[model samples]
Target: MNGDWLLRGRDGRLSVYQSSGDAVLCRVERAPGGPWDEPRKVGGEQRLLPVLAVGQGADRYAHLVAWRPTVQGEAGLVHSTHFRARLAALDWNPVGHPNKKGDRTGTPAVAVDAEGRAHVFVRNKGGGVSMLAQKEKGGWEPWQDIRGKGVQDGLAAVTGESGRVELYAAVPEGLLYWRQEEPGARPVLKESLKAPVRPGTLYALATSPASTTLYYTGTGGELWAWRPGGEPVALLPSAGHGPVAAVRCELDGHDCTLLAQRSASGRVAFAAYPTELESAGAWWTESGPQLTVDARVSLGTDEDGRVVAATLSPSTGTLLLTRRKDEPGLALEAWRAV
Candidate 1:
């Protein structure tokens, strides 16, 4: 998948997961330095689609989910989480196959609540939403239907700043939202939000303890940010054509929001602005070697909580990594291939 290729373990080591052909390959960071272990096959063979990995809660267990074709009109969703410990890629667990024919099942998106339960949500065949949650006893509940018609295929989910799981689906009109009344509770659908969000470009990040921001590319190619109670703020001097990899970190002594996207020119474009201040402004700078526009960009923190971002070049099959330098601003060390 052109999403979430990087995962940070509890010990702050990172693993980069990618599907090379039908197998899932993983490369682990041996230590904090630039040296990395070679990529090894982690997942078995299947007619797989895009892969997604979500790390959540204090344990920060990363749950990897992938969809693969089975029989006619039937498909399977599989999951894998911490095996032995963090940075270990082991076995795959089944989430059952759904056999809804004709209108094929949509792609899967996943998030974990404060207690570290995986809640898998997808667009059902009828154009509405359905969800499955991981039980405390380590099994999945039967898929439950959450009503929201005309939902587009790509869905964005996040464990919100409040520790409640929230989901967003884009319809033709605007955004359909679902949020839990409390942590570990089922997310209830809220009234539709009005925006011209482009599909496959919607992602949410908790930029602060009190604020979670929604970022997306607009129908007119502009980038927009919206919070729960504010207008959709268009980012100035936008230059990307896809979703963004975002993080909140202290740049020197000031809090900043860092964003990275694959610019239209096929390079990793990045910038950082003061957190929650769009009008204050930031500019886009392209970095690294030229990669495809759909190349996945990911962000996480090192053992010391310094920011790190990475991307893989399909053309050369090399993992390109960068890190936040110990400077007064959001400066980065040179991009290196591993």
Candidate 2:
């Protein structure tokens, strides 16, 4: 539930991740959706938390980052890559601990910049933030203390259309965040807004290169959207139980944002909105029958440019995916077992 569970690589193959037993398991496609290979324990004996897989660069290389418990509940984040083949077909490079003492950390979050360099952030043991950035050509830089106070984990990181990286975390004061003034520069705390936000439910939509709209679930599981200088817009009073899944796509010529959430009945409930124009109003739409299990939904664009929604079947721990119909709107095909 921490990292992105679904990603489509540049090579047209898809990968799905899950936290199975004592490891972070990954299953890659032989083709676009299935037939998928068996789940591989990519974290080795690391006792991983949920696996996070994201694609970066023109080649769309999939980077795997996960947290493993270390000394006295302190956690270390490990990094690895899947180049152009099956996941871990290349090498699993370990990024190890930020400090020799291995300070305790909240769940780590990552945002790959425009240049494809990953910027990693976490709520350090100090209740502040610390960051790890990748060098321009190779290697990772030292972990720098990006100070803050009363910050929570479930950090949300994303690169804006302007190529700047932004980080957000819930704090007692509302939301504490940082944004880079320009590309490749280290970000600093730029805004601590008076917004009510549920930590770990944040998902962002880059409306423009310089602007992004944040989507998250409220304390009562209602869906809300907000931007840096705008008031929070309530979209759905009931949007399931946890983190929302969102993606930006063009529909019927209009730029729209598509959202999916696990409904109260353990089914996938979704909706669409005019991107950045939430004042136009929106409506919640339920698709498919109620699922017996409460699993999270993840969205990704297919090789054909159709939005693909997937969830790990709780009963079988396998992937269940459905593709957007080739027509308009958010209509989707029936779920296909992978």
Candidate 3:
């Protein structure tokens, strides 16, 4: 019912979206740390769990998809709709078919490649994996079934440095990974990356254009991350079983991956993965628990990928900007590895 995701537009502006009953509310900013505009409602009451992606220049647009459950002829069914917002217009325009329905297997996920094409991933009613892609001119391709089996876990998408668009999902057994190497590229499924099955959701952080890290909660409120080249490692000694949110941006003059998750005590905890200048690995920092539980977390960055602002969710918290001068307090602090 509140905003849960943050994104930067091609025009160097930041936008936040949250569900408000049947409609989605959007708040925009000229830049990450500046004053935010008043929230505007978009789409209809049936629109829920909206996913977004931003494209380039004239191609700059916010692609959104949502699902609403309804009863038709005594059969309960979930229907989905897709929309796109032209950043310059600040309004959402319906695109694609309005009658799309899902098997309700999982929430939809979207990612835009460097070329400005939108790639959508969703699980169907029969547990089948499917993808719908946007065409170069301006239309969506028919849904292509990637796999026949459906999954109940949530889905996420990212565009890697190789320009390949990758999708990740959490299945009962382990984390599933798939990639579409290029536009029109077939979906290639990888072996399930093994992990313990306690904490509920999986969150992905693209530490760099080419690197991504997956984080999830473990038994006993521990936070763990699937490192790029290593096995899963414990991140926080005590984290909530709730979902995690993260972003890749610049921090303290370095490109870093910032992470947010709930602590065992229900307050949000912040962490950072500072890139190692000389090596392939990185240094991660764990901070003390503070802030609202399950707060919507987002990071904003400059062209070079330096993080300029971090907006913790609920639409009422402070915009943690890069310190103009050395600041006090750990919540707004950025740390470097010793």
Off-target runs (Cα >4 Å) in candidate 1 are 43-47, 50-55, 83-90, 97-104
- Candidate 3 or 1, higher lDDT: 1
Pairs clashing within candidate 2: 161-209, 162-209
Residues 143-213 of candidate 2: C-alpha lDDT, one tens digit per residue: 88887888876777777777678887888767776888777888888777776677778876578756987
The superposed Cα distance between candidate 3 and the true structure at residue 264, in angstroms, equals 3.5
Worst 10 residues of 2 by lDDT: 50-59
Q: What tens digits encode model 1's per-residue C-alpha lDDT throughout 268-312?
A: 888889999989878898887778655778887877878899987
RMSD of each: 2.3, 2.4, 6.0
- Runs of candidate 3 with Cα error greater than 4 angstroms are 1-4, 30-32, 43-60, 68-103, 148-150, 198-200, 208-210, 227-230, 251-254, 276-294, 302-338
> CA lDDT of each candidate?
0.75, 0.74, 0.53
Whole-structure CA lDDT of model 2: 0.74
Model 2 per-residue lDDT at 32: 78
* Better model by lDDT: candidate 2 vs candidate 3: 2
Runs in model 2 deviating more than 4 A are 43-58, 69-74, 85-91, 96-100, 292-294, 313-316
For candidate 1, which ten residues in a row score worst on lDDT? 96-105
lDDT of 3 by residue, 169-200 (tens): 66665567777755557667854666654523
Residue 190 lDDT, candidate 3, scale 0-100 = 57
Question: What's the lDDT of the predicted structure labeled candidate 3?
Answer: 0.53
